[model samples]
Structures are given as structure tokens and as C-alpha cells.
Target: MSTEIIYQTLAILLGFAGLIWSADRFVASSASIAKNLGMSTMTIGLTIVSLGTSAPEVLVALSASLSDSGSLAMGNALGSNVANIALVLAITAIVAPIPIAKQLFKMEAPFLVGVTALLGLFIFNGELSRLEGLILLLLIPVFLWLVSRTQTGVEQEEIERSEGFKTFAWFIVSLAILIGSANTLVWGAKGVALTLGVSELLIGLTIVAVGTSLPELAASVASALKGHHDIALGNIIGSNIFNIIAVASIPGVVGPLAIDPDILSRDYYVMAGLTALLVIACALTLKRRGSKLGRSFGVVMLSSFCAYYYFLV
Candidate 1:
């Protein structure tokens, strides 16, 4: 390969490493803060943990948008959501099956579907305008407020435990790493796409999306291993919501993004389908505690992801 290729490869590797480290630091800080505040683990998982893990996706999409690769930016957002459910959750389920909560089925899962449907509607016209972006951005604060208001006393205590000066410091450091790594990853992904004669959309759909989603993989796996199935489920669901409403919204808010209408007609619809499948799977598995996600479910998820990848490439 050429020197440019080598530099790009190195940048990609460094970016991945930075993302993992940042995620770890963010999780630790969040956990510590929660512990200090006597917050419930579930609350911590739902809020701080979810936000921290989803930071890389936000950063990556923002960088891609700013760099003028609208397709890649949107692809990363949508693709990451698909991967979070199909790949990350599948792998976690295979490793250690997570039990589903009834509340999740009734509330969060439906919310995910709603946000995804809204996303499809927003992009249906082939462009995400500044006004639409602002609307999406506005939803973040409302969501946060709702979470704060609805979280139980135990959850609040957990959040307080995790809150402290050190936690704030870690958050700052993680934010810096998230920004730097996103830039590096986008640059590297663009280089690779050019070198291989592939579209940036393919790179975003596969490499960039997968690299940034490592945080979700890590968080979910950790939760699964710890026998906190609810945490594992919550992480994936929360991240997907954030990916659509927050990460994907940033680009259009900063500036209008012109998208291929096919994304709505094709990819977005596929995403909705996959999300529905996830909800069904969760519902089916709700009655069993500590039960392994059967091989069939894993195979189905993996198969769906593979099919999506093939279509993208």
C-alpha cells in the first residue's frame, strides 16, 4: 500500500482505540457518580451510561456532516442503530442472555419505534432541513427532563452517587477524545473508501459505523456478564433512541443535509423492520429469566445484519 494508505490505517486504529478508552473512562465516571449518589443501577444505565456510550456516534456523525459527506453522516447514524440492535445486542444475547422488562416492552421499545418512524418521515422528502434539525435537538432536552422527572428516588440516588468533580473531569476528557477520535475516524474512513474505490456510504455503513459502535458493544457485554440483563437491554434501546434523535439530528441542525430519497424508501424501512423484529424478540423472551437467547434468534439477527451489509456494499 501507499504512505497515505498506511497513515489512514494508523489513524483508523488510533481512532478505534481512543473510542474504547473514552467509553471506559466515561462508564467508570458515571458508575462512580451513581454509586456516590446512591442511584439505582438501572437509572444509571438508562441515563448517564447511555449518553456516555452514545457519545462516539454523535461525534462521528457530527464530524462527517461538517466534512460535507452527508451520505456518510446519515449512513453512520442509521447504520449504527441497525448494528446496535442486530450486532451488539445479538452478540450480547449470545454471550449471556438478557431478560426483558415489561416496562421496556410498553414504553421504551415503543418510543424507539416512534423515533425511528419520525426519522423516516423527516427524511422522506430527500433532505433534512435546519428547521427539522432544531426540532430534533429540542427533543433532547425534553427527553432529559422527562427522564429526570420520572426516574425513581433510587435512580436519583444512583445518579447522585455518580456525580462529583472527578466525574465532571472524566466527562470533559471523554468529550475531547470523542471529538478527536471522530475526526480521525472520518478522515481514515474517507481515505480507505477512496483507496478501495468504494463509496463513502459503504465505508460509513460498515467501518465507521461499526468502529463508533464499539462502545455499545462494550457496555452491553459488561452488563450481560454482570447478570444485569435489564441494563444490557436498556443500553441498546437508549442508544438507538439517541442515535436517531440526537446524533442524526445534529447534521441537519448545523446545516441542511441532502440525502438520497432511497435511504427513506429502502434503508430506513429496513431499519424499522429490524427494530420491530427486536421488539418481538424481546417480548418473546420476557418470561424467561437468565435464559440463553436461543441460537435461532442469534442466527436471525446476524443474518439480518449480513443482508444489510450486502445491500449497502
Candidate 2:
């Protein structure tokens, strides 16, 4: 191993740690603020926490796209979806099978499918244009409106959120760390990829993708363990939605570029399939008296994820 490669490897490791911690800090502070502000768990999970967790991907997308590495951008946008489902959710389910929240099952779950379908349509031509990006951005508010309706019967809680000023201050600090760590991660990923004689897309698909996705993993797993099922399940669904519409839009707004053909034929389908699988899981589980994501399902997802990595290797 060369000296530069070693340094890059260290950077990636440090980058992952930084991104994950900052993401957790951001989500905790944001959730507390939302709860304190009179939002229900459902609303907090879907809107505040979800968007907070996906902040890394949004920034990384803008950074990569503006640097004229659209393929890298595409890889990060799509690859993270696969990681979120196959790795993050899978591991969470295996550790403690996540129960589908009732509100989430009805609204956010279906909305996730709709958003994914819309994103798929945009990239169908293997290119995302500025106009296309504008359309995606427009859909976010629409999605938020739909999400708002889902919390109709849910009652908001009023918490004092002690140390409100402190939480807000920490949130800002964490946000800064998230942005800087993401830049370091992407830079190290591209560097390591070049050293290994691989394309930036490949780097984004695996290393960069997983590194950026650490936030989702940490947030989801922590939520699941703490039995915040709404936030746990919603985080994955919301982040994936953000990944598609928000992350996908960055390249278009920054500088429209063609998506890789491999993504259309291979990567996009994998992402879509995993999403469909999740939708089906929710359907089958939600219909029962008490729904649960069993360890068996986790095994299936994890197996597929491992196979994907093996194939990539």
C-alpha cells in the first residue's frame, strides 16, 4: 500500500466516524426541537428527523455535481438507497425487527413508492436535466403536504425541551461537521478509487455510498433499539425519498449531466426492487393483527446486500 493510499484510508475511516456522530447529534437535536415545538412523533419522524438524517446525502450530491463528477453524484444518490435498505434496514431488522407505524404504513409508505416511481421516470432516459431537477424539487413540498395530512388524528406532545438553546447550538455545530466530513469522505473516496484504478462511479457505488449512508444506519438502528418505531421505520422511508428527489436534483441544478447507463440497467433496478420489497413487507406485515419485521426478512435483505458487494468486488 502506498503512503497516499494509507492517508486516504485513514481519512475515509475518520470521515465515516465523523459523519455518523454528527448525523446522530443532528437528528437528536432536531427531534427534540420538533417535539418541543408541538409536533407528534409521526410528524417529527417523517419531516424533521428524516430530512435531518439525509442532510449528508444532499450536501454530498451538490458537492460532487458541482465538481463535474455526475457519475459520482449518481452513484452516491442511487447507491445510498441500496445501502439504506439492504444494509441499514436489514441490520436493524435483524437486531430488532421494526414494527411498522400505523400512520407511516398508510401514508409515508405509499408516498415513498410514488416518489421512487417519479424519480425512476426522470432518469429513464439516463440523463437528468435542469428542468427535470426543477420538477423534482417542486415535488418535495407536495410530498410534505401529503405527509402533513397523515398526522391528522395524531396528537402533538408539548415538551419543555430543557436546554433548548444548547440543543440548537449543538445542532448548528453538528451540521457544520456533517458538511466538512462529507467533503473529506468524497475526496478520499475519489482519491482511493483513482489509486485503485477504478472509476469514480464505482467508488461512489460502494465506498463513498456506504460512507455517506452511515448517518441513516446510525439513526435507524438507534431509533429501533430505543423502540421509537415510527422514527426508526420513517427514517429509512424518508431518507430514501430525500435521496431520490432532493439528492437527484442537485446535479441538475448545479450542472445537468447524463447518468451512467449501468445505473439505468443495473443500479436503478436494484434500488427500485429493494424498495418494492420493503413496500411488500409492510403490506404483508401491516395487514396482520400486529406487524413485525422478522429476522428471516433481515437475513434475506442482508444476503442480497452481501451478494451485491461480492458482485461488485
Candidate 3:
């Protein structure tokens, strides 16, 4: 192989490795903190666990934004959301079909769709201004507060336990791993993009997107394997919500991102369609009284993703 091919291969391998390691670290640390804090399984599934799993995507977007790779930054955020639903969830279903979270459909999924639509609207102005970014950033705290307000008494105890020294320690460790792994993946992605003569947008959409989404994949798969339908479904729904509002929002604030109008017009619409498809699937599955995502559903989701990939190429 040529030198460029070798570098590209190495970059892709290292990126994948860093992502997997970071994901494992995130799961371990999050689970430990949640356990120590006496958090309920549902609360953990919705908040702390979801945030931990999304840390890699958040870090990657922030790093890319700071580096002035606006397209890659935004693409990672949007592409990861797309992948989380179509790719990650599909794989998890194939491993062990995951059930839909009814509450998630009523609450978080709508919020996710709203945020995604808002993002598309905001970027239609060509660039996400600093003021817009600030607005998006402010929304994150508000969202957390809203989620907290809806928590049950049992969930409250879990949040309370999340406040001690051990919890803080786990948070710190998870944050460190998140940052370190993000840096490694970004560097490797850049190297690979250069060597392969591919745009960073493509890299972010495919390689980087998949890498940052590893945590979600791991979390969903684990939940499915354990037959915790709510946890499995909640994690995917929450992560998808965060990827759009939280992850995509950061780039808008860190710096102005000039979104390709074409992306907004085309890809963004495709993303919305995919989100709708997921919602429809969830509704149909629930109607059928099926707790597990069936093989046919998994195949449809996977095939949709494959078609999207082909369009990208």
C-alpha cells in the first residue's frame, strides 16, 4: 500500500480504538456513580447515563468547532444523531430487539424533533451567530431542569446520591477520558481525511460519526441484552435528543458555523424523515404489543441507513 493509504488505515484504526476505550470508560464511570448515588434505573437511563454516553460526541463537536472545522463539527453532531437511530439502534435490535419507551415518545422524542427542526431553521441564515449559540447553550440547562421536574420520588433519591465525593470523582474521570479520547479521534480523523483525499464532512458523517456514537451503541446493546426495554429505548431516544440540541448547539456557540444550505435542505430533511420513521416504528411496535424490536424493523432501519450511505458516496 501507498504511504497515504497506510496513514489512512492507521488513523481509522486508532480513531475506532480511542472511541471504544472512551465508551467503556464512560459506561463504567457512569454506572459506578449512579450506583453510589442510589439513582433509580429509569433516572439513570434518562439523564446521567445518557449524558455519559453522549460525552464523546459532545467533546468531538466542541474540539472540531474550536479547530475551525465548522462543517465537520456540525456534520458530526447531525450525522451522529442519524447514525444513533438508524445504525446504532438497528444493530442493537439485531443483537436483541429493544422495546420502545412510551414516556420517551410522549416527551423527549418531540423535543428532539423540535430541536432538529430549529437547528435547520437557524442555519438557514447561513451561519449560526454567537447570539444564536448563546441561546442554544442556555437551552441545555433549561432542558435538564425540565427533565428533573418530571422525575418521580424514586428518581429524586437517585439524583441526591449523585452529589457526593465519589460521584464527583467518577464525573471527573469520565470527563478526562472524554476529552482525551476526543482529541485522539479528532487528530486521527484529520490525518485520515488528508491522506484519503476525502472531505472532513464525509469523515465526520461516516468514521467520526460512528466513533463518537460507540457509547450509545454499547449502552443500547447492553440494555437490550439485559432485556431492559425501557432503558434500551430511553438511552437511544435521550442520546438522539442530546446529539441534536446539546451537541449541535455547542458548535453554534463556540463559533459561528456556516451550514451548507444544501445540507440543510437535503440532508436535514432526510434526518427528519429518519426520526419520523423511528417514531412510527415505535408506535407500530407498541400497538403490536411487541416489546422487542423485531428483525423486520431492524432490517428496514439498516437498509435505510445503507441507502443514505450510498447517497453520500
Candidate 4:
């Protein structure tokens, strides 16, 4: 490759690494700080923790948006949802079948579908106005209210466990790194796309998108292996909701976003289909501790993801 491309390649690699680590630290510290300030476990779980896991995506979207890469911003939001479900959860299920938390099918899963449908309807007009962006942002509180009701039994231990190795100073440092690296990630992605004559949507869908999704892959697989099925599936469902509603709106909030009809026609459809599949899988195996997702389901999900990636490529 050319010298500039090599440098950009390094930036993307380092950016991914920094983002994963720093986002982890940021989440931990932020949660710990809130806990120290006497915030209730359910409140922290529903708000800060959800925002923490999704921090990389929101930051990436903001970075891409401010950099005038609106397509990248939109692509990252849609692409991350696709990866979170089809790829991340698929691999998690393959490693260990994720059990169905009865509550998952009852609330969060359906809420996610509703939010995804809302996103679909917004883009149906072939554009998302600033007014639409504000509407999406306003819906976050409604989501939080829904989460609070469902998470009424959210345990203190779950919140503590999610916060790993908390460090207040390191949180600030990592927060800075996360912001800086997000810009780096976006710049490198745009550079590589330009050099290869690839569209920003393609670059965002393939490389940049997957890189940001690394956090979900790590968290979900770890949760599944540990038998914390709620955290495992909940992480994917919650993050996808956050990505669709919050992260996707940043481009328009920052500036005018040109709607890509391909998103409505293709990528978002892949997201919607996988989401419906998740709901069906949960409904079929509704037992709380049952293997709603076994190796067979894993194979199917993974196959679907592979086909999606193939289509993208």
C-alpha cells in the first residue's frame, strides 16, 4: 500500500485498541463515581451503564458527523446493530447457548424492535431532519422509563460487576483518549475509503463499524460464558436500541444528513430481519433457563451474518 495508507492503517488499528480499553475504563469509572454519589443501582444500570457500553458508537458517530462524514456516521450506527446481533451474539451462542431471560422477550426485545421500526419509519421519507433527530433524542427518556420498570429487580451486584477495576483518574484519562481516538478512527477510515475509491458507507459498514463493535463482542461472549444470560442478551438488545435511536441521530443533530436509500433498501433490512429472528427465537424457547440459542441456532445466525458480510463486500 502507499505510505499514507499505511499510516492510516496504523491509526485505525490503534484507534480500535484505544477505544475498547478507554471505553471500558470510562464506563467503570463513571459507574463507580455514580455509585459513590449514592445513585440507586437500577438508575445507574438503566442510564449510565447503558450509555457507557454504547459510548464508542456515539463517540464514533459524533466524530464522523463533525468531520463531515455523515454517511459514515449513519453507516456505523446501522452496521453496529447488524454486527451486535448477527455476528457478536452469533459467536456468543456458538461458544455457549444463551438462555432466554423471560423478561427479555417481555420488554427489552420488543422495545428494541419498536425502536428499530421507528428508525425505519423515519428514514422512509428518504431523509432524517433535525426535527427528527430531536424527536429521537427525546425518546431516550421514554426508553429509560421503560427500562426502570423492567429493571425493578436490577441487583447491586450486577452493577458492581459491570464496573471493572474502577479508577477515577484513569477514567478522565481514558475519556480523553476515547475522544481523541474516535477522531483518529474516523479520519483513518475516511482516508482508506478515499484511497481505495470506496464509499464511506462501505468503509463504515465493513471496517470502522466492526472495530467499534469489538466492545459488544467481548462483553456478550464473556457474559454468555459466565452464564449471565440476561447481561449477555440484554447487552446486545440495549446497545442496539441505543445505537438505533441515539447514535444514529448524531449526524443530523450535528448537521444535515443525506439519506442513503440503500440503507432503507439493504443494510437496515438486514438489521430488521435479524432483530425479528431474535424475537422469534426467544418466543419459541421462552423458558428462563432453557437454551433458546444452541449450537444449531448459532450456526444459522453465523451463516446469516456471513451472508450479510458477503453482500456488503
Candidate 5:
């Protein structure tokens, strides 16, 4: 490899590590602050934690867009959604079968589908306009409003004011790290793409997307292993939704982003198919009164993921 490629590879590795580590810390501190402020567990999980989990993608989108690589940002959003389900959720299901909560599925699935359809409509014309981006951003508050209504009955415990202040400080520090690391990651990714003579969209879809998705993979597996099945599935759903609306919108808001044909023809279809498969898999489990998604289904998901990657290559 050339000297530049070596340096770029190192940057990608270091940036990924920093991104993952700081993102975790940021989310933890944010959740602590929210809890200290008397937010319920469900509300925190749905709003703060969900957004926190998606921070990497959001920051990366901003970084890539600012760098004038808007197609890369769009690829990251779409490709991350594909990876979140096909790779992350697949691995998590295999770790331990995830149980589908009927209520959670019913409430969130429609919103996910709705947002996905909205994204499709916007992109069908081959470009995302600033107005469309703003429209997508406007839906965020509506999503939060719907989330607030489904408050769980869990009681909030009080925390010391000093502890809350400390968490807030951590939040700020980690957030700064997140921003820096995202820019670093984007720089490395663009470098690698240039060296490899691949399009920025390809790099974003393959390398950058999977790297940014590591947190989701880890979180889903841990949740599944710990028997927090709802959390495992919920995290994937929430992250995918954010990728579609929030992350994808950055390019449009920054400047008009032309849609890559492969994104619509390949990646988007794969993502939508996997999402439908998930809905079907969970829906089948719901018939058994929220039974678990079995190892067999997991194997199928893994197989599909492998097949998709093979097709990509």
C-alpha cells in the first residue's frame, strides 16, 4: 500500500474506535441527565436513548455533507439501515432469539413504514430538495410527540444534583469527541475511496456504513443476550428510522443531493425487503402471544445478509 493509504487506514481505525467509545459515553451521560430530570424510563429509551444511539450516523452525515460528499452521506444513511437489520439484528437474533412485544411493534412499525415511504417519495425524483429535507426534519417532533404518549409505568428515581451536573459535563465532552471523530472518519473514508478508485457512495455504503453501525451491532447483541429482547429490536427500528429521516436529510438541507441509481435499485430495495421480513418475522411471533424469533429465523436472516453481501461484491 502507498504511504497515503497506510495513513488513511490508520485514521479509519482510530476514528472508528473513538467514534464507538465516545458515542457510548455520550449516550450514557445523556440518559443519566434525562433520568435526573425526572424522565420516565420508556420516554428516555424512546427519545433520548434512541437519538443518542443514532448520533454517530447523524454526525457522520453532517461531516460528509460539509465536506461536499453528499452522496456519501446519503449512502451512509441508506446503507446503515440495511446493515442495522441485515447484519446487526441478524447477529443479535442468533445470539438469543428476540421476543417481539406486540404493543411496541404495533406502535413503532407503522411509523417506520410511514417514514420509509416518505423517503421513497422524496427520492423517486432522483434528488432531495431543501424543502423535502425540512419536511423530514419537521416529522421529528411528531415522532417525539407519539413517543411521549406511550409512557411506561416505571417510576423515576431521584439523583443528586451534583451527579446530574457531572453527567452533563461528560455529555458535552463526549459530544465534542463525537464530532471530531466523525470528521476524521469521513476524511479517511474519502481518502480510501479515492485510492481504491471507487465511488464515495461505495465507500460510504460498505466501509463507513458498517463501521458506524458497530455500536448498534454491539448493543443489539448485548440486549438480546441479557433477555431485553424488546430493547434489541427497538434499537434497530429506532436507528433505522433516524437514518431515513434525520441522517438522510442532512444532505438535502446542506445542498441538493442527487440520488445514486444503485441506491434506489439495490440498497434501498434490500433495506425495504429486510424490513418487511422483520415485520413478518415479528408478526408471526405475535400470533403466539409475543413468542420468540427462533434460531431458524435467525439463520435465515444471516443467510440473507450473506447473500446480500455476496451480491454486492
Candidate 6:
């Protein structure tokens, strides 16, 4: 490998590490600050924590948009959704079957499909306009509200409170690191894409997408192992919704983004198919009591993920 390629690869690796660490700290600091301000744990979770989990994708999209690589940003959004289901959720289910509450199937899962369909509509014209971006952004509050309603009367999570100055300092520092790391990852990804003669969209779809999705993978798998099936499935569904509405809007909001035809023709189909499969799996196993996505379904999901990657290459 060329020295330049090596440096770029290092940058990508380091960037991913920094992003994961800093994003975690940023969320912790934010939670601490919110708790200090007397915000309820559920409120902080539904809003700040939810957004925090997607911080890498949001920042990466922002950096890619500013650099005029909107296709990469779009790919990050779509590809992250694919990875969340086919890879992260798949692996989690393999570790432990994810149980689905009938309520989640009736509500959150359908909401994700709706959001995905909305994204498809916006990008169908071959571009995402600034107006469409604004529309997506405006829906965030609605999404949060809906999610808050679902969590009504749920147990409150215990949060740790830190000193005000320390919390603020960490928040600022982590935010700065998040931005810088996102830029570094974008630069490195673009460099690698150029070096390999591959499109930035593909790099975003594969490498950057998976890297940014590390948080979800970890959270979901850990939650599943601990028998928090709702959290595991909920994490994936929520992240995918956020990606469609929030992270995907960055490029369009920054400037009009011309989406590649392949996004709709190929990637979108893959994402949508997996999403439908998730709902179908739940419906097939749906019991009046609950639905379980068993090890068999997980194997199918993993196989589909491999097939999708093969198709991509």
C-alpha cells in the first residue's frame, strides 16, 4: 500500500475511535447537565440520549455536506439503516432472540416504515431540496413526542450528576472532538475512495456506515444479552428513524443534494426489503402475549446482510 493510503487508513481508524469515545462522553455529559437542571430521566432519554446515539452520523453528514460530498452523506443515512437491521440487530438476535411487544409492532415499527417511505418520496425526484430538508427537520419534534408517549409510565433510569463546571467542560470538549473526528473520518473516507477509484457513496455505505453504527451494535447486543429485548429492538428502530429524518437532512439543509440513482434503485430497495422483513418476522411470530425473533430469523438476517454486501461489490 502507498504511504498516503496508509495515512488515510490510519486517519479513518483513529477517527472512528475518537468518534465513539467522544460521542459517549458527550452523551454522558449532556445527561449529567440535564439531570442537574432537573429534567426527568425519560425526557433526557427520549430527546438528548436518542440524538446522542446518532451524533456520529449527524456530524459525519454535516462534514460531508460542507465538503460538497452529499452523496456520501446520503449513503451514510441509508446505509446506516441497512446496517442497523441486517447487521447490528441480526447479531443481537443471534446472541439472544429479540422479543417484540405487540404495541411496538403496532406503533414504532410502523412509524419507521412511514419515515422511510417519506425519505423515498423526497429523494424520488433525484434530489433532496432545502424545503424537503426543512420538512424532515420539522418532523423531529413530532417523532420525539410520539416516542415520549410510548414510554409513558415506563421506569425511570438512574442518572449520575456531575459538578456543573466539569460537566460543561466535558460537553464542550466532546463536542469539539466530535466535529473534528467527523471531519477526519470524512477526509479519510474520501481519500480512500479516491485511492481505490470507488465512489464516496460506496465507502459511506460500507465502511463509514458500519463505523458510525458501532454504537448501535454495541448497545443493541448488550441490551439483548441482558434480556432487554425492547431496548435492543427499540434502539435499532429509533436509530433508523432518526437517520432518515435527522441525519439524512443535513446535506439538503446545507445545500440541495443530488442523489445518485443507485441509492433509490439498489440501496433503498435493500434497506426497505430488510425493514419489511423485520415487520414480517414479527408478524409471523406475533403472539397475543409477545413476538420473538428467534435464532433462525437472526441467521436469515445475517445471511441477507452478506448477500447485500456481495451485491454491493
Ranking by TM-score: 2, 1, 3, 5, 4, 6
TM-score of predicted structure 1: 0.84
**Tens digits of per-residue lDDT for model 5, 120-184:** 89998899999998888788888887766654554443423338668988977876676566557
Per-prediction TM-score, please? 0.84, 0.90, 0.83, 0.81, 0.82, 0.79
Q: Say which candidate scores most in lDDT.
A: 2
lDDT of 6 by residue, 1-313 (tens): 8899889988888877877677566656756776687654444433554465577798889888999999989999999999988898889888898766656664677888898888889999898999999899888888888867776555433567699999989977876776567557757876877776887889889877877786677556655664445556766777888898899998999989998989979998898888888888877777535557878888988899899889887
| lDDT by residue (tens digit), candidate 2, 1-313 | 8899888888887777887778667666766776666666667677777787678788778878888987887788889999999998999899888776566676788877887888789889878889988888887898788887877667543433747789889878876786567667767777887876988788878887887777777777766765566677777888888888888788887767798888888898899999999999878887885869878889999999999888877
TM-score, cand. 5 vs. native: 0.82
lDDT (tens digit, per residue) of candidate 4 on 133-153? 878888888888887777665
Per-residue lDDT, model 2, residue 116, is: 83
lDDT of 2 at 107: 74
Best by TM-score: 2
Better of 1 and 6 by TM-score: 1
Worst 10 residues of 1 by lDDT: 154-163
lDDT of each: 0.75, 0.79, 0.70, 0.74, 0.75, 0.77
TM-score of 4: 0.81
State the number of backbone clashes in model 4: 0
Best-to-worst lDDT order: 2, 6, 5, 1, 4, 3
Q: Which one wins by TM-score: 2 or 6?
A: 2
**Pairwise TM-score winner, candidates 3 and 6:** 3
- Model 2, global lDDT: 0.79
RMSD of each: 3.2, 2.4, 3.8, 3.8, 3.6, 4.0
Q: Which ten residues in a row have the lowest lDDT in candidate 6?
A: 40-49
lDDT of 4 at 170: 66
Clashing pairs in 6: none
